[model samples]
Target: MRSTPRKLSLTGLVALTATSALLLTACTDASQSGTDGSTASTDGESSAAPSFDPSTIEVDEAAAALLPEDIASAGVLTVGSNTEYAPAEFIGEDGQTPVGFDIDTIKAVGATLGLEVEIQSADFPAIIPALGTKYDAGISSFTITEERMQEANMISFLNAGSAYAVASGNPDDIDPESLCGVTVAVQTGTIQDEDIAVQSEECEAAGEEAVDILQYESQADATTNLVGGKAQVMYADSPVIGYAVEQTGGQIEQLGDVFDAAPQGIVVAKDATDLAAAIQAALQTLMDDGTLVEVLDGWGSGDAALETAEINPSVG
Candidate 1:
C-alpha cells in the first residue's frame, strides 16, 4: 500500500444516527476532493491550495543523457501517482492539477533533468506493477522493501512508518499489538494490508479468532469505514494516520507511535538502471541545492526529509 496526506473537522460520520443526506454529502465531498475526501489542510495551514514552483534549476547534460532513448527523445518524464494521498500527492483545490510534496518534488526533479513531467493518477497498488510500461516512474510514497526491490529499484527520498488510529477515547479498546479479532481497515495493495494479513495469520496460528480485515481501493474509503464504525481501527503511514485523526476533530485519535520507520523511494523499473541513476542524481542535486528540503517544508513534512538520496538502501 501507498500513503499520502489531510486533516479536517469531524463531519459526524461517527454518529451513526447521521441522516442519509449527510452521508451522501460526505460521499460527494470525498469524490470531489479525492484523497480522504476532505479539503482541510492536515498541517493547520491555509485552505487555499498550496502551490509548488520548482526552481529554474538547470539540467545537467550528462545526467540527461542517462535517460532511455524513448524518454530522452520524448523530452517528458511520465510519472504515476495515486493522487488520493494528500500532503504527499493529491488533487489540488481546483480538482484538476496534482499537488503536494511528492508532486512538487518530482516536478523539481524533472526540472533538474530538463524534462516535462506528466503525472498520471493511478491506483496505489497498481502503481508499482505499472512502472516502466505505463509510467517512467512511480512517485507515490512507496516504502522501500526487499520484496519490492526485487521488482523495481527504489531511490530513497523520505522516511516514514506505519501508525494506527482508533475512535477517540479508545472506545473500542483497540490494541495496536494483539489485534486478534479486531476489524481493521486499510487500503488494498499497501504494506499495511500485508502487515494486517500477517497478523491475522498469526492469530489463527495461535488459536485466536483471525482479524477481520476490510480493504478499500483508496485510503479515503478505509478512513470512512473507520469513522462510520464499520471498522474498529485503521492503519496507514504515520503522516496519513495523523492527517485522518486531525481531520476528524475529536472523532478519531492516533493509537500508537509510528513503528517500522523506513525510507520511501521513487520507484524505477528493475531494468531501468539508467533512469534510476538519473533520478538519483537529480534528487541529489535537489538535496544539495536545498530544493528537496523546501518541498518538504512547504507541505509540513520536513520532519520526514532524508539527508541523502540512497539507491536501494538496505531495508534492514
Candidate 2:
C-alpha cells in the first residue's frame, strides 16, 4: 500500500437508466439476502455472451491439492459478494442468480479447484468482515489497498482504475480536479466513501466548502439520484462507469480520465494462507491455460486482465 490518500473503490456508471429495462434494484441495508445462482442477469450485454460452460473449466490437481483439508472435504467455495455493480457482478434478471465477470471468474476458479461455488449477496461493507465465517471468500471487485491487506489477504488478479461521471451535458458543471463543496454521490462502505471523506477533510483544511458526499447503500440508488438531478456527480471503478454510460443511452458521461489504476484481489482470511495459496495457484493455472482471458474477455473486460496473480501483491 502506498501513502497517498485512500481512494474509494467499486462504484460504476448507472446500471439503471430511465430509458432501459432491467431485472433488479439496488439494496443498501446491513442485512444480507440469499441467491440460488439459478439465472443470469440481462442488464450487462456489453460483452459477447459467455461461449463456454463455467462448470467445464478444467481442474488443476496441483491447485486443488493446496486447499485446506476442511475446505477440500466440503468441496464448496462459498463466496460473499456485494452483487450490485454491473459488468463486474450483479444480481441477474431472475433476482436469484449472481451474475457478472467477477462471478464467472470466481466460479471458474472454484471449478479448477474441483469445488462447487456458492455466492451470497451482502452489503458492500459487510462482506469482508464476515469472511472465513459467513463466507469462505469475497469475490467483489475488491481494490487492493494497504488497509485491507492488514485485515484479509488480498490476492491481485485483475487491474482496474477509478473514474467519475456526471449527468449528460455538464448539467452541474462540476470539476473533477477540485471536488470540494460539490455534491458527490458514491456507494457506502466502498473505498470511494473513505476517499471522499479524505477529500472533504482537505476542503476544510483549505477553508473551502467540504464535499457534500451522499453515500448510498447501492450504486444504483446513487446513480438514480444523479440521473434524477439530485447529485451532481458520481465516481467508481472504470468498467462500471462505462457500463452505465452505455446502458443509460446518454444520460451520463464520464467526468474525467480513469485514474489510480490498481490491481483488485480475491479476499481470503489473513490466517487462511492455505486457502490463499490454493486460490492463487488455481488462478495461475487458469491464466496459463488461457481460461482467464477467455472468460473475462467474453464479458468485455479482457482489457484489465493481469498476466499473473500474486498473493498479497505489493501495491503503492
Candidate 3:
C-alpha cells in the first residue's frame, strides 16, 4: 500500500490564513486612475476609477523615478521567494545553498545594476504582501497577471506554463481530464492552485468526482509525495517538471503538454515603479548580451521560449 501524504495541521492552516490576510492588506490599494479620467477599482473594489493624463505621462521618466535614491543607496536588493521550485529556484545539490535559473538570472540583473542580491525564503503566496518595507524585490518564478497587476508591479522576464510530473511508465496517463477523481499534488496558494481549481470545476461539469487537490507547502514536498505514490500526479511549472524528470534519472516523466501559459516576472512593491524600470532595463540588456539564455541553459531549462521584450507596464 502507498503511504498517504500528511494533511496540513490545524496550526499550519491558521498560519496560512493569517499570512493570506496580510497579503490581502498589501494589495488593498491597487486602484489607479484610468486614461479616461475615471477611477478604476481592481479585484473586487466598487470605488470609482481615477483619471490620468496619458499625454503628459512620461513613461521613461516615471519608470526611472520609481527606483528612488534610497533603494539604490541601500546597495542590496532583498528578494523573497519559496526557492523549492526547481529549475526556477531550488536548493543546490549541497542541500543548503540556494541555487537555480531564477537565482542566476536575478543575480545577473543585480550585477548589471551594481546591486547585491539577497534572497529570503517565504511562503510562495505571501511573498508579494511581505514586500513592503522588508524586501526590495521578489524573484520566485512569479507569473504576471492582470489581477496581480492591480496589487503589485510585475516586470516579466520569462515565458512559463504549468505541466505535470508522474512516475515512469505513464500508468495513469494523467492529463487534465485524467486527473478527475485522482489525487493531484500542488504547492499551496500558487498559480498551480488556481489552475487545479479550474480543472476541478471541469471535472465536476463532466459528471466526475473532482480530484482531491492536495496542497503542499513547497514543490519539494509535492514532488516527494508524487514519488511516494501519495498523489497520482504533481502539478508544477513546465521548466521545473523538466528539471525534476532529468534529475530523477528517468524515475519520473513529464506528461502532457503545457496547459496554462503564464509569463513569469519579478515582483516589486506596487508603488516602486523606478525599481521596476531599472530591473526591466537590466533584463533587456541581459537578453541582448545572451546572458539570459546562458543562465537558463546552465539549468537545463528551455531557452527558446524566453521573451526579451518587456510585456507589461511598469505600474498599473
Candidate 4:
C-alpha cells in the first residue's frame, strides 16, 4: 500500500499552511458516537445532555480506599487522551474545556474515588506510550488488543468495532473486503490503518492493484477527504463513522454493521496494578449507579455500553 502523509506530518509544509490544513484534525476526535450534529442547543431549550459537574457526584468510601496510597494522597487521576476524538473526547464549543462521554466518564470515575480528574491531550499514538510517565491512565476509546495489552493493562469499559463508510449512495461502489485498487482514507496509528496496510499487501500478491492508503493525523481529516471526494472509502471505529455520517447531513453513509466488535478499555500502566483495580471498582460503581448509561446515551453512544468493566477481557 502507498502511504500518504497529511500536511501536519510533512515537514516541507509551511508552519502557517500546516496550521490551517490541520484545523479540522486538531479540533475533532475519532471515536465513533452516533451524534446528530446537534450537541449544543440552538434556542433556549432544555435537553438531557451530558453535564460534567464534579459537584454532582459524591465520593464512594470503598472506591476511594481502593486507590493506591500515592494516588489517594495526591487526590488526582491524570489521564492522557487524544481530545480531538469526538463524542468520546473533544474540545467543547468554547474551545477550551475538554468535554465528551469519555471525559465525563473519567470524571465520574474520579469522583467515585474522591480524586480530581485532570485530562491532558496528546497524539493518540503517543498517549499509550507515555503512560506511567506522563499519564496515570488513558481513556481514549482504546480497543483492547493483544498488542496493546502487552504494554499496559486494559480495563474493559465500552464495546466498539470497525465500520466502513462511503459517499451517499456509495457512488464509487466501494466494498469493505475487496478494495484491491481503492483509495482508502484512515487515521494514523489506528487498527484500521494497520488492517488496510496488510490488505494492500495481500492484494498486490494476488496480482491485483495495490490499495492507495491515505493516512491523516486525525479522523476529522480522513472524513473530510472522504466527503471532499479525495478518497473512495473511509474506515474507522463504528461510532466514529456514524457520527461522521450524521454530521455530514447525509453526504456520507455507513456501509455495514460494526465488525470485529471488541471491548474498548481504559489503559493503566503495567506497574499500576493497584490503580487499575481502583479504576475497575470505580467504573463498576458508576455502571451500577446509571452514570455510565447517562453519559453514553447523552452522547449518542449508548449502544457501546459495557455490561461490566472487566480487566483484560479476551481480545480475539
Model 2, position 162, has a per-residue lDDT of 77
TM-score of each: 0.84, 0.85, 0.75, 0.84
What is the lDDT ranking, best to worst? Answer: 2, 1, 4, 3
In order, the Cα lDDT scores of the candidates are 0.72, 0.72, 0.60, 0.69
Q: Model 2: per-residue lDDT, tens digit, 1-316?
A: 1112122223234443221223334332211111221111233232222344777787889999999999999999999887777667776545556777788899989999999999988876777789889999998888887878898998777888878889888877888899998988887766677777899999999999999998776666666566656678886777777766655556678887888888888998889999999999999988888888888876667878788999988888
Error of 3 at 294 (Å): 0.8
Give candidate 4's whole-model lDDT. 0.69
Candidate 4 global TM-score: 0.84
**For residues 56-159, what per-residue lDDT tens digits would candidate 3 score against the true structure?**
21223333344569867887789986666655665543334556667777777777676677888666777777776778888887777676777777877777
Residue clash pairs of candidate 2: 8-191, 8-192, 9-191, 9-192, 13-240, 13-241, 41-92
Error of 4 at 225 (Å): 1.0
Model 2, residue 183: C-alpha shift (Å): 1.2
**Cα lDDT over the full model 1:** 0.72
RMSD of 4: 7.1
lDDT of candidate 3?
A: 0.60
Q: How many backbone clashes does every candidate have? A: 9, 7, 12, 8
Give the deviation of candidate 3 from the true structure as CA RMSD: 16.1
Ranking by TM-score: 2, 4, 1, 3
Off by over 4 Å in 4: 1-50
